[model samples]
Target: MGTFKIEGGHQLKGKIQPQGAKNEALQILCAVLLTPELVTINNIPDIIDVNKLINLLKKLGVKVENIGKGSYTFQADEVNLEYLESDAFKIDGRGLRGSIMIVGPLLARFGKGYIPKPGGDKIGRRRLDTHFEGLINLGAKFRYSKEDQFYGVEAEYLTGTYMLLEEASVTGTANIVMAAVLARGTTTIYNAACEPYLQQLCKMLNRMGAKISGVGSNMLIIEGVKALGGTEHRMLPDMIEIGSWIGLAAMTKSELTITNVSWDDLGVIPSVFRKLGITVEKQGDDIHIPAHTNGYEIQSYIDGSILTISDAPWPGFTPDLLSIILVVATQARGSVLIHQKMFESRLFFVDKLIDMGAKIILCDPHRATVIGHDFKSTLKATTMTSPDIRAGVSLLIAALSAKGTSTIQNIEQIDRGYENIDSRLRAIGAKIERVD
Candidate 1:
């Protein structure tokens, strides 16, 4: 296990470049398995999860060549589907939910796909029933074997049709889209996830000869084709990390600029942060954060009352970022309620925040009202362990702002998302050291 030791009360000041999104890179990598030709991807985040997925792909006989900094050429000219039966092939699948996405492309290209149950944050019950249902609608046969704890799918000829997902699952929608791209007919998907990551996936698939429309909306219309070719793509900068940097600058009164941020793709995220009293200035592809901000006051409703911040599916505030927003809100001048509707267990970390001598109310598993103390370097340090990626970042925010030294353990969860986080924080003057 690894931990972060931080010396608090130092302001982070400097410019930083955000890393490529881990979520988007995962789906795009799996899409590589759809074609044997060469696919070159640039700006790929060098994170733990991305590395794990790449290792898993290499074990399946995909020839991956590094073409320089943050660039790689992947050639899956000969996929050894036999590896799907080995225990080594199942290592990444059981540890990350993104591993489940490989099932769709493997089945589409090789006629058969074997995948074990996926593992991710235990925030709630992440069911694969919807993924299975979506594939079955595409003329695929599914079988579950208890001996291997694997789900097998086979299809001689896949035909696409209309699919209404049970929920707007991020990876589930991705799996179905990849499978539908090469099917026999047109595929219509309703209530699909339209996150920017998904939109990028659709665009990449289209460049590879899959006709997909409504890229940024819930209703996707995919015109299936016989085959897809390899294409070059550059992964988008991580919005979640950009958001975290914004929160860091606001909380620490630091001047920071995030380079290479896509302003057009960040729908509702900038406005959401502005509502929390954070100002974001966009200059071309850069997001500039002004220094020495007083942690703006949360604006009240028209009736002059407190307001609330909540999360929803795409086009709304993302649930993954609410934790970071809440931590930032804790230093603001007013009160706000954070309602996490997506996960029942995400708000459990507020107790740790409360133990740090902050004013907070754990209304339940789904809601927490945070009162900003504006301590501004008055909080005493403490020991805590990270629970998830987003929460881990939030803890780092808290640790960085505390009055004394603080220790945060189990940073592997954080490494799964952010790339070279400790070094990046060091670049901005955050006094954090990583120890194993």
Candidate 2:
């Protein structure tokens, strides 16, 4: 594990660009296995999870080349199917959750696919039922071995059909879509996740010679084709990262400008922050967060009830960002409740913030009440450990506004998503150092 030593109470200035969407990159990289032609991708984030996926693709015998910084060209024309039966895959596929996506394209292009039980952030029980059930509905034979913890799927070829998902899981939708793209007949998926990341994936597949309709809706119709061709794709900016930066600016009294944010795609994120009384300015393509000298305050609803911020599906405020919202709320003037409906364990990080002098009550595993300090008192720095990717960044934001130097260990969790986070923070005048 690595550590970050941060000297707090310094306001930051200047511009920073968010890397490519981490979640999107996972889906896009796995889709490379769908075609035999060269698939070129741009704006690939330099993060640990993404790099791990890239290396996994190479180990599976996909010809991958780095064209430039954040650019790569992949050709899956000569994939080694035998590797899937090896013990190496059983070990390699367990590193990240996105590995589950590779099974879809492999089953589509070839007759079989194998993957080890996937692992990711231990926020809650993330099930693979959606992925496996969707594939089985498309005429694939699925089986799991309890002894090895391996999932195996095989079929002569998939036959597309109509299926309604139990939940609109983002990665589950991507996996099934990849499988359905090459299956015979037409596949109609209802109750799908239509996040911009999934939308971009559908668009890229359409450009590669697949027919998919209902790009921006919960219902998607995909007509199977004999084979897919190669196409170039550029990932959108990371909305989660942009939202984090906005919260960081307000917490530290920094005037920060985030460039190339694709403002139209950031649905409900800016408004969610603005509800916290943070100053959010949309200047063309960039978002500007001015220092709140008066301190941010929570806005009340029309009925004069205390405000509540929670997570939901796509159009809803993303569940991934609630941690950032929770940390930022500590410095606001009024009290608000944060409900993390999706993951129960994510709220446990609040104890660390409370130890830093912020006023908070852990209502339960899924809820927390934050009473803002109104900038009247700064948080006292202390030693802490990062639990996961989003929580790590949230703690970093809190530490930046604290009164003294704080040491944060287990920063490897933060590096899994954000690319060059320390260097990026330093560029904007933050006093953070990376220590081994």
Candidate 3:
């Protein structure tokens, strides 16, 4: 456990590179289990969750090689199929939510897989029904032990079939797709998630001999193949971190250049920030945010009504970045409603912001209205506890903009997603120090 002490009111200015997409890296890492060949992945972020998943793979007997910085070669030919039954398996599986994806590939290859109840950010009730139901549709028999909180699935041989997901869950879609890539016959998924992460996974699988079509659409078709070969894949820059940096720059009145952000992948994030009157300049593959002068007003809808920011499936604002948006809005010139449609308890962290002298009304568990101080009243620094990954970073941004100094405990929550965040922010002149 560690804490971050930040001296606020500094105008950060510099160029920084966003880490590889954590979501994409998690899904891509799980895909490596589908093929026994030497799968090389590049641009992998060095974060806790991704590293934990990699470590889990290593313990499962996958051959892991540190080819270079942020790169690895994985071969699952030697994966110990019996390891899943050990007590350690449940411990590792529950460490992070991404470990749940390992079940799909394992079940596809070995006809059996099991996972303990997964642990992750307690944003809301993230159900595994979509995942289990989709796998069951593919000819897998699933069993849950309520007492032990264990989830297990097995099959003689997975047979492909049609599945319409209850929701286009990002991880759920990735899991089902991985299982479908090896099953016999064709698999069709309607209402599938088409995020860039899933697209990258499908592209990599296709390169490795999986017949998958409809890469960027809500519907996907997969013709199961008997085997897959190794392929080299690179992860996309994290769009969530990019959005966070943009919010940080706006909140701190800093001029920042985010390098190689994969401009085309950031759907409506730039526009959403622009809605708050922050100027985002797109140059080639980079995004430049100029220092903002006070007077940032929340843009009312064309109907001339109150502005509301909410999350939906891909092509919509991601729920992960809603906390950052809420914090940035605390300094904007107008009040706006933040509706976190997906997660029920995520917005509760706004209470910490309220304690920092922010004018926010917590309407309920999922919605809050923030009235910006617009720099007329500088936020007073205070000690706080970092909750989850996204909320931790959001509070860090708030601390950077607040007056005097603030201390944040449980910064490990922040480190789980953002790679070397304190060091990276310090490079850009942020007055942040990490203490053990």
Q: Point out where model 3 deviates above 4 Å.
A: none
Q: Per-residue lDDT tens digits of candidate 2, residues 288-329? A: 988777888899998988899999999889999999999999
Model 2: number of clashes? 0
Local distance difference test values of all predictions, in order: 0.88, 0.95, 0.93
Global CA lDDT computed for model 1: 0.88
351 Cα displacement, candidate 3 (Å): 0.8
Better of 1 and 3 by lDDT: 3
Of candidates 3 and 2, the better by lDDT: 2
Off by over 4 Å in 2: none
| Higher-ranked by lDDT: 1 or 2 | 2
Query: Residues 395-417, candidate 1, lDDT per residue (tens digit)?
Result: 89988888789999999999989
Query: Model 2 lDDT vs. the true structure?
Result: 0.95
